[model samples]
Target: MTPDLFGRHRAVLPDWLALYYEDPLEITHGEGRHVWDAAGNKYLDFFGGILTTMTAHALPEVAKAVGEQAGRILHSSTLYLNRPMVELAERVACLSGIPDARVFFTTSGTEANDTALLLATAYRRSNTILAMRNSYHGRSFSAVGVTGNRGWSPTSLSPLQTLYVHGGVRTRGPYAHLDDREFTDACVDDLKDLLGHTRAPAALIAEPVQGVGGFTSPPDGLYAAFREVLHERDILWIADEVQTGWGRTGEHFWGWQAHGQNGPPDIVTFAKGIGNGMSVGGVVARAEIMNCLDANSISTFGGTQVTMAAGLANLAYLLEHDLQGNARRVGGLLLERLRAVAARVPHVREVRGRGLMIGVELTRPGSDEAAPEAASAVLEEARAGGLLIGKGGGHDTSALRIAPPMSLTVAEAEEGAAILERALRSV
Candidate 1:
């Protein structure tokens, strides 16, 4: 008999790790945008494993690449020549839009952002970082220090001083009622005012779309405006594209592309989806900035051959299939469907997002107060309805996150939307 240690694994797992649902799911396998639990219950996976499965689950191209590479070699350290890593790096550097770009690989988004912080601080010679309010970067010390959300931030202990800035969330804060142009101006004015009092800082890092912040984002061109201000002051701009990169947003190949008036950011960090669920995270920057450190550095497992092969294949599939276009069409339909449902549901705050990345904010029926309980109920309800979704918010967990695989079809979107409608209304 098989040694089924699943129960023991759960019991002994770290207390810090939060499992979803009252009865946690055990995903045996997946295909396309659907998965099956240990009990063989099928679920239309709207979250796509937190958007890591960018193209599809069990993608044949990626699987073949991984298998072929693993059979040849698995763990060649970054110290050696890795062809797949180099190939993937070339593609990312070209796509990043940063002139004279250099690429560095890491195993996770936390490590990628940590590396970017190191590059910015070292190159600019300042330990200070500017992050948007209600934004989340990662869980590392440097990453968490710059995170402006209270719920996701676990500790205040940080080596660098992080100044919280505005203009990340469009539908919240004092400027929520303002129009797009007015809101942009207010946030810019506030940013200028903040800069006047503080000492010189290294960079202003932001996610064009705040993933864990409930899929929130400022109006278009806000970051370009911010970049203009930062440029004059010689402050670097880092776009944390961990969740928003690789055409997930539909209208743009990169989220920062939507704010291209001032051109690309000084640096860009990417992860989650490029590998189609493989652990692949990296930073792209101007060669000068990336090469600023005099001492030598290399990641032990950052660009392992196997992961790079998977990423190369997955990225190829995404580009070849024009899945970005699919995301645009399917996601627009899904968004419209959800919005129609939200219009009828009293507690539904807003259905917002572009492409496959969408968020439905839940609130109390009669009040502006965050209704996390409602969101949780909706999540459980969706699961029971044979759909899997996720949740986050500027407020403690009041937004439902919907990010199906990029390959989600029109029929699947309709099916998932119908299930979600019932879940939201019932909850």
Candidate 2:
């Protein structure tokens, strides 16, 4: 980015809104998985605008759908009947696996999570919520209140009382040394013990794969074991799939499916990828819980024609092309390559994630201590090497996030992995 543009951005935008690079690039336009900066430097976009571009950059199908819909009507109130909205909702309800599923649209993931919190608290008749450590829900007051990551949680004041739990991260925390089964059992035991000491909370909200927590996740069926306990107490299980949804996780269509023995989560909140860059977020729940609200509420521009049209097209393209399978095949290859690279690099603590959503944690040269500075150096090096990635961790922000578009080809993956390998070693 030019100094003038950077100075203008700092002068206008909030300081809390973070930028990626020391000299942040103003992206001019993009196509496929490549984006060009204002300097006309093209970089392979591995971050996919923080995983919002689930399909590809400037996809023709999505653009055509948005253009057609915009040519007709731009905005429509939620009070009126909307064909595109209803159609997209039907698709979502069918895809959502929740029986008697009802979909409520919101403009962003934060709003979707807010709606989920409202329904859970209203139905369960408790303002208490259970969340996992190092989890990120969103930025709104209600969303941030439940967030367990101190870097993301800005305020201590909140309307709901929240309790933090274990089992989100597998290789950290006190149980990191245990095997998968013993680790899971220990987390479940901890949960059971916690519930014994407190009132029944409204719900347990967790990202099946902790996105911002360096893509760390517990052993499979851990949630199912927890569900066995929560179900006995009538505590709802809510899966926050904002970053892990839309087949990005490769092995599972939904991140929660890795622990599917207990059946689907009672409530699921999603956003960030369904519209392929358009603002689309929603909550899916069973009819009883969704209809438990006493008063009417509507999202003014939640299901606008333009956004829904783009969602429908993107969903169709994603499904028809079987991008999920592509992610599995190509992402498996990429993960192995990055792991091989990590094996040769000492700064890398671990490389973990499934499918397109991967994270490489960095530590100090010869210590286990978190290295935020090393992470920043890798980001700058990766950008200079013509690649764009992201970083996030519990508090120190020492993990490199690599989630490209689902349609990323094997060639692109190889290219990105090479760039990333160079960045990791160079840093």
Candidate 2, residues 235-273: lDDT per residue as tens digits? 999999999888999888899999879889999999989
Return the TM-score for each candidate structure.
0.98, 0.99
TM-score for candidate 1, please give it.
Answer: 0.98
lDDT of 2 at 322: 91
* Reference-based lDDT, each prediction: 0.93, 0.93
| Tens digits of lDDT, candidate 1, 1-427 | 0125456766788877887886677888999999998888899999988989999999999999999999999987988999999999999999899999999999999999999999999999999999999999899988999999999899999999999998999988899999999999999999999999999999999999999999999999999999999999999999999999999999899999989899999999999999888999999999999999999898989989999999999999999999889888999999999999999999998899999999999999977889999999999999999999999997579999999999999999999999999998897
- Top model number, TM-score: 2
The alpha-carbon RMSD values of the candidates against the true structure, listed in the order shown, are 1.7, 0.8
Enumerate clash totals for all models, in the order shown: 0, 0
lDDT, candidate 1, residue 138?
93
